[model samples]
Every structure is written in structure tokens, then in C-alpha cells.
Target: MAGHSKWANIQHRKGRQDEKRQRVWTRVSREIMVAARTGGGDPGANPRLRLAIEKAKAANMPLTNVNHAIAKATGTLEGMSYEEVRYEGYGIGGAAIIVDCMTDNKVRTVAEVRHAFLKHGGNMGTEGSVAFQFKHCGQLIFAPGTSEDRVMEVALEAGAEDVITDDDGAIEVLTAFADFESVKKALEAAGLTAEVANVTMRADNSIELTGDDAERMQKLLDVLEDLDDTQDLFHNAAL
Candidate 1:
């Protein structure tokens, strides 16, 4: 795993509220629907659904809304079907970027995604262009000054793969996708709350950006994140 820049994480969290709440709920509901459709509505039997529900809870989505989404996926209610899509690109400072989305209208989604890239000093790439620079894993990151020893002990005992502290003193616990929920529970039970937790494509390396490049990159990310269809976005830039 590559060391993540705290500034990037801070900006992401700080800017999340700028996105419309309805859009966030839509994206998370799509995730739940897909997970339930693929596995089952029972969270105990479906890891993906469990994770989706966890995210819904974190976002403070209404329980009624969550139940309705699951019901739709389980065929108890009507719902708009969606498909997942990924876009790769290079942003300012030559940083690799990946945009993940879910949409019922592929044509509209692609057109908007491409336009956002081009409008923000970025260029879209072929499917595999920048994905090679990332790793698919479950990541739980703690803020700086967290107790490294405690995080490591609880995480490793709960089947985490690694506990790394970056140059900025942030502690990151990496786990296999299968072990993510278990490890997360253990860490929380140990009172080591995470600042960010998700199953994501983590960059394997990073490019440092400064001055105009950094400002442009941040703007590009903000634009992409605000897209209604975008579920998640990742990049290998240290702002």
C-alpha cells in the first residue's frame, strides 16, 4: 500500500458536505441494491450488503430508506436498475485518477464523465491505463497521534494484513476484503476509531503536487466528486 497524504483525505472529508445529500443517498442506495442483488438481503449472509449498510449508517441515511432500498433489490418494490462503470485518467501533475460510478443511463454518464475530465485539465485514458497503479483492498485510516501499538495489536489479531504509519504519522490498517468487517469491529471495540474506512482502490505510489498544479488537482477532484452518478473517486496525488 502507498502512503496516503493527509491533506487529500482532509480535503475529501471537508468537501463531502458540499455534495448534495440526495446524490449521496442515491449512490449509497445503488450500492446497497447491487450488493443485495448479487448476494442476498440478509447482511449476515452477504458481506457486500453488510458493508453497504454500514456505509448507509455512517452517512446517517434513514432506516426506512435503507430498508426500502433492500426491499427493492429483493424484489419487494420497484427500482431503477443500475450498472457500474469505471473511468481512468491523468490529472494535473501527472497523477493517476480513477472514477467509479453507477448509472442506469450509460450514454449520459460517459458523456458527463468525459466532459468533467476535459474541462478540468485532465485527459481520459483507456480502461487499464491507470488502474495498475492501485491496489484493491480494505483500508481503515486513523488520524495522526493515534496509538500505533494498540492499533497494530487489535488489527493483526483480527486478521488485518498490515498496520502502517505514514510519514505524516497517520496510521493505516490494511485488510483483505473478506476480513474488513471483522477487523473494523475489533478496532472499534478496542476504542481505536477510524477517520476513514472503506473498501477502495488504494494507490501504490503517489506524486507530490504543489502551487498551481495542486490547486488545479483539488478543483478537478471536487468537480468529479460532486457528480450525481459518481460513487467514488481515487487518485495518487499528494496535494
Candidate 2:
């Protein structure tokens, strides 16, 4: 997971201002809509919606937009009916890759995803082909200057499984999926905010790549991420 950590660190250094904030807002809004539609619009009564709203607020997404999404999800207004899809594949250096998406058209989404892999020296694979190489876990990342010991104390008390310090001084708390919300709330109540908090697939093992292979891997991942339908991209490449 070194590569994943490295990539995450790089993204943090770049900061949210470096990316197109509007694009990020759109993605977060879509997430909110989907979570609300599936779990109901009331965050107080819906854990999934609550988490989605938390993420949206963290991104500084407009409250009006967030409320409108919930309304649409609750059928107070019309909205796109998105379906969740997962695609597994192998990238350069035999790195395992997984792409999560929310789309209204599976056929189009699959075709575009497969083309992305093939065009980038990767190949899409059958379901479970590379999925078994990963595990879904709750990940929470804290900014620098946050006390690791203090964060760990609260996280562990809240049922976090592990707290790791990355090379960039960022703290990452891993927890069982069931304990994610509890742990996050604990941290928030203590005035510790996570830069990134989500349930994500972590690779069980990683492959190392350098030189041209590493560059190619980065480009491929970027292309995959740029896809509007793509939600999250996970890979086993050790950066």
C-alpha cells in the first residue's frame, strides 16, 4: 500500500484548490443523491445519507445543492436514477485495478471502461478476477499537525483497528466497516477532522513499478479517474 499512500500524499500536497472544485462538487452531489435514494433522505435516520452529507460539507458543497439532491432522491423532484457498478482489471506490471461507478447505462459504462484499460496497456477482467486481492475497509485520513497519539487514543476507543502514520505526516485510521461512522463521529466530536474519510477497497498486496512502467501506470490511473462515470479507482501499484 506504499504506492497508494504516496499517491494520496501527492494529492494532499496538491490541495483541493488545484483540482476543478466544480467537478468534485458534481461527484459529491451524485453520491449524496444516490445515498439518499437508497437509504432515505433524512440524515438523522439514514447512516449512509449522513455520511454523504458529511463528505459534501467537507468539500464545501453548497447547502442548497445538497438539500435539492435529497429532495430529488425522495421523489420531491425528478433526478437521474443511477446504478452502481464495479469493474475489475489488471494494469501495467500486473497491478490489480478496480473501478467503481454510478451510471444510468451499464452497456456504455462497461464499453468505455474496457476501452480505457485496453488503451492503456491494461485489460478488463471477469468479476472477482482481481477483487479477491482487495479488502473493503473504512479509511480516515487526518491532516498534518494532528497529534497521532491523541488521534489513536480516540480512534482505538471508538473501535478503530489500526492507526498508521504516513511518510508525509498524515495520520490514517483504519476501522472495521461497521465501526466507521462511530469512529468518525468520535474524532469529529474531539475536533479532529479527517481530510478523507470513506469506505474503500485496500489492496491486500502491491506490485512495485519504476521508470516507464510507473509513468504509464500514473497516466492510466489518471485517465480512469477523469471518466465522469468513474467514482473510485483502486490499484495495487506500489508507487
Candidate 3:
């Protein structure tokens, strides 16, 4: 919460080329499968599944595909079972990176991830290496020109943990994972929608990188993101 909004990363991901956006469907489908598998197939009873569904919708995934993934995860159909794996690493200038993936083959995922790191001026670390630098929570970010007072009133009244307005005028609403759904519902009801909304491992501090260091870090991140099994990536770098 002390550093700037993680919106920078979100924006960078959102700005991926049109060709790269095609891969988003695959990633969100895996997310849907894992969420359903972990918390039943009923979105009404499972907040994670509900969020995954929302992501699927945002990605423009077909409803048929969504239902099929849920069915497969719930055992109505045969499919490769997936397990979540997290990789911690340091990018150029010692920037912390956390990569989350869902894969049936852990060995392949790890090798691909490690190769990306080593080949792009990074070092993969053991579990718990840089995780201590982050907090797993819900984040909702509004644009710089949005109405801050209105957002603060609605968010705080709906159980938000904190509302931060950055020096650059961006509004950030922080919530516990448990309160995320409720807060998001309230904001939407009030006709206030966020530019970025998700449950994420938000960095507690940021590493400012520029010039060669920043360029190398971005290249490393792009490689990891393009991997077929990679689900999500987080970093503390403010490039």
C-alpha cells in the first residue's frame, strides 16, 4: 500500500498486442477450471469461481467453452488435472518477480520458467524468496480523473480496507479477499467501475528501474507471460 498502484503492471498487460490478447482466453479458461475445481462449480456459492467467470466474460470467451471447462473440472468430463505452482525470481537490478501458473506437468513449467529467467538476466529463487515483500489482497483501481470522494464513500461503507489517492491522482481501493466481491458489487451498484480489479499479490515496496535495467526486466516479463502455462505474473518493479 505504500508504493504506487500495481495498475502499471495491469496496464502493461492490458496493452499487449492484439495477437497476444488471443492467449488471454486460454489463461482465463485455466483460471476458471482451477477455481471451479477448488470451490465447486456453482458460481453463486463460490466467490473465486464468480470472479473467474467475470474474467472469462471480459476476455470474450465463449459460454460453451466456459461451461465445458467447469464440467471438466467438476469431473463430468475427462481432462488433464492442473495444479498451481508459484515461481519467485529476481529480474535486472534485483526486482522481485512472482509467477503463478497452473499446469499438469510441473517439471515442464519449472524448466520453461527457469530458462526464461536465466536467459533474460534474471535468477529464479526458492519458495518464499521474495513473497515476503508482497501482500495477497484485493485491489480495485480507478483512473486519475475519477471522482475520488464518491469512490471513497461507497467503498468504505461497503467494507473496503483502505482507499488511497496517489499523488498522481489515481484512486486505489484496497480490500481483504473476503470483502472483494461485496465491495465490487457496491461500487458497481453506485455506477462506479474500476479500470483494474482483481485479487493479487501486491508488492509492499517498489524498485524503480530505468534505462537498460528496465528494458531487460520488461523483456524477461514478456517471455514469462507468453508461456502457455503461465497464468499470472507480479513484480515490484516501477519501470
For model 2, how does the per-residue alpha-carbon lDDT over 8-93 read when each residue is reduced to its tens digit? 63474237434767777777788888998888888998887888888778778999999998888889999888878999999998
Query: Could you say which candidate leads in lDDT?
Result: 3
Candidate 1: TM-score?
0.94
What is candidate 3's lDDT per residue for 1-239, written digit by digit as tens? 33364556657778883457668888888888999999999999989999999988877789999999999999999988999999999999999999999999999999999999999999999999999999999999898889988999999999999998876678899999899989999999999999888999988888989898889889999998899999999999988
Question: By summed lDDT, which 10 consecutive residues of candidate 2 come out lowest?
Answer: 1-10
lDDT (Cα, tens digit) per residue for candidate 1, span 130-204: 999999999998988899889988999999999888778888999998888889999999999898888989888
Worst 10 residues of 1 by lDDT: 1-10
Candidate 2, residue 87: the lDDT equals 98
Top candidate by TM-score: 3
Model 1 / residue 142 / CA error / Å: 1.0
Report the CA-based lDDT of candidate 1 relative to the real structure: 0.88
Which regions in candidate 3 have their CA more than 4 angstroms from the true location? 1-8
Which residue runs of candidate 2 sit more than 4 Å off their true CA positions? 1-18
